[model samples]
Target: MSRKVIVTCALTGAGDTTSRSEHVPVSPAQIAADAIAAARAGASVVHIHVRDIATGQGSRDVALYREVVRQVKESDVDPVINLTAGMGGDLFIDPSNPTVHLPGTDLVSGLERLAHVEELRPEICTIDCGSLNFGEGSQLYISTPDMLREGAARIRELGVKPEMEIFDTGNLWFANVMVEEGLIAPPPLYQLCMGIPYGAPADPGLLKVMVNMLPQGAEWTSFGIGRNQLPWVEHSVRLGGHVRVGLEDNLYLSKGVKATNAQLTERAISIVESMGHTVATPDEAREILKLDKVASA
Candidate 1:
């Protein structure tokens, strides 16, 4: 076990989970409150993804992001806010037509995608390196090389730390290429997303392979969705990487047990401590991620 680890709470994901858990924050106020609660429960960072209130679906709207960021910052909780720039890249292609997009496809330009990050200027923002066949079938989260480079360049220009999100080995390769091209800043931040079907599995062996592929001295945190959440928390920290947890990834504390964001974060903290590792506080995480102490927004 490492001496110290940082726990991040992914408050509410863009997933279809509003109906699954009563604790999943739908409104901006609820999202912010859940984030603050996660911080109070021992998370040093809160990874956020805002949703449309009426529909309770994922969105890439700048106004939604602004509201969420504002509320989290204004709250007494000082957990490092990490916004998701992963939206606006969905490509549910028309299989029959092969050229046209399906109903759910929501592809936008790299500039449009990063507009929220540019506006909010959070401590950290995610830049998905490449696209992949998401889920079991019929959906694809498309992020081309040109688009990835453009997103990375924009994040670098805005002076916001880009948390390079790697879903598979190719994404990692593209990230390394970005590091070489100077699109990504030095000592980069990474989030190894595992076990989302068609991408890397949540297996410990696969996690190790991905961790080994990271550039030397890179700071990374890893998380798996659903059942893999808690197990990967221990897997990440044991491999000298940090951990992320919360309702966005998994809804249960145990069998049929609905968990709030704070409950998940608290559980991750316990795992970290049980391994003889200390979970980083907000201040410690700030220094570790090289984040600005104050938000520019």
Candidate 2:
């Protein structure tokens, strides 16, 4: 590969992986420290999802986001921040009584989900392209057309790049539709998420097709959760797209070996280098994605 590949570290996802992995960071200070460490390890971007400190569950708290971002910006390393706006869409329903919402249900409007993004205004914020049966339950992650349109319009107004997440072909199709409708700004960034239960499986053929499906000149990255994470780095780089890795997507650096954000990032950098390609810095990544620096807010 002749191009500089951008590596993103997705630290501590909203999932209940905390119970399984001791390495997952839940508090704001820990998340910020992890983000800084990942940046120092050569990651161009840090994709953050705050977790509730008390319960260790995913949170959309602006205060948490503020503290994390503040710490990162004040740190020595400057990595591109990509906050998750994919929260607040979780809807757990009872199969027997479809209308009954389960206890952990967190359904909210799309704009409401952007509370953190609006306040912190990071360089990038992810927008899930469509709704899907998120996992092995009646849980549905909702992102309707009208909701998405409204979010996109607001994100454009704020001048923060929306990192469109493509979990399936349908999501990709709608993202393209959004592009045509002018909801997204130019040189859109896309993150192809795979191996997430009910969404797209971690298949190379499908990944290639999805890459082809992306609009010309789009900056894209791909990742697979669990065991597929590290291998997916190679897969994504081989296809000329960027790569994402970290504890959020995968717990282990190798079999039964837990990994930290920095360890995962170092491995990804090694992969990019082994492939005879350079890994991008934050500024280089910003140039690749055509992003302007968002002031600390």
Candidate 3:
């Protein structure tokens, strides 16, 4: 743990966790406030996913994204913005038909998912590398090679770094293929998502294997959902990678304590610090990721 680790705080995920935790930010203003607070708490980057205010469900509306980004930009802190382009891929297949999607399904082309990234032009945008049986029941997350290729090209053109989201080994394989095909830029970023039902398990050995599989000079991060979140922070740092934590992945700060975004961020910083490693500031993270300097800085 010699180098500074970039801690990303995912404010409010596109999940149905609002009912689970009262701290999950819902409105554009709340989300923006959470981002600022997390940045102040030592997060170098803020991974944002806006929710529909009325239903507390994930949304791909560019207008909603616009408002969130706008508020953050005007705020005091300067954490790097990483918008989630992973929303438009939710697919809830009907149990009976198997072909038709369920009520909560929201499937679209890869390029369509980048509407916010295109308009907002955040420093970093995510590309969920491949499809997955994301969780329990009939839900799936879709992202074909064709869709990914097009999305990568568009993000590259937009001059935003693509944080390759790898749920399993296959996703990593396809991400490498995209990099080799020249769609992804140099020093590609990856996010190894663990403990998500049907994806990779939350095993240290497996995370090491996935980390080894990353292309040379690639910067990556990993996170384990639920109770594994905090432990995964230390795991990622010890493995020479960055880390992410927030209410999006887990709700608890302790055994029964519901955590706020800022509290989760502070706790993550404490973990990194206790491990003899310093946490990166917003500017340092940008330099580490090779992202552009902030405008009017």
lDDT of 3 at 235: 93
Task: List where candidate 1 sits over 4 angstroms from the true fold.
Answer: 293-297
Question: Please, what is the whole-model Cα lDDT of each candidate in the order they appear?
Answer: 0.86, 0.92, 0.92
lDDT by residue for model 3 (51-78), tens: 9999989899899999999999998888
Q: Rank the candidates by TM-score, best first.
A: 2, 3, 1
Candidate 1 residue 187 Cα shift, in angstroms, is 1.2
How do the residues 183-237 of candidate 2 rate in per-residue lDDT, one tens digit apiece?
Answer: 8887878899998879899999999999999999788899999899999999999
Residue pairs with backbone atoms closer than 3 Å in model 1 (clashes): none
Error of 2 at 200 (Å): 0.8
lDDT of 2 at 128: 97
RMSD of each: 2.0, 1.7, 2.0
RMSD of 2: 1.7
Which residue pairs does candidate 3 place in steric collision? none
Q: TM per model?
A: 0.96, 0.97, 0.97
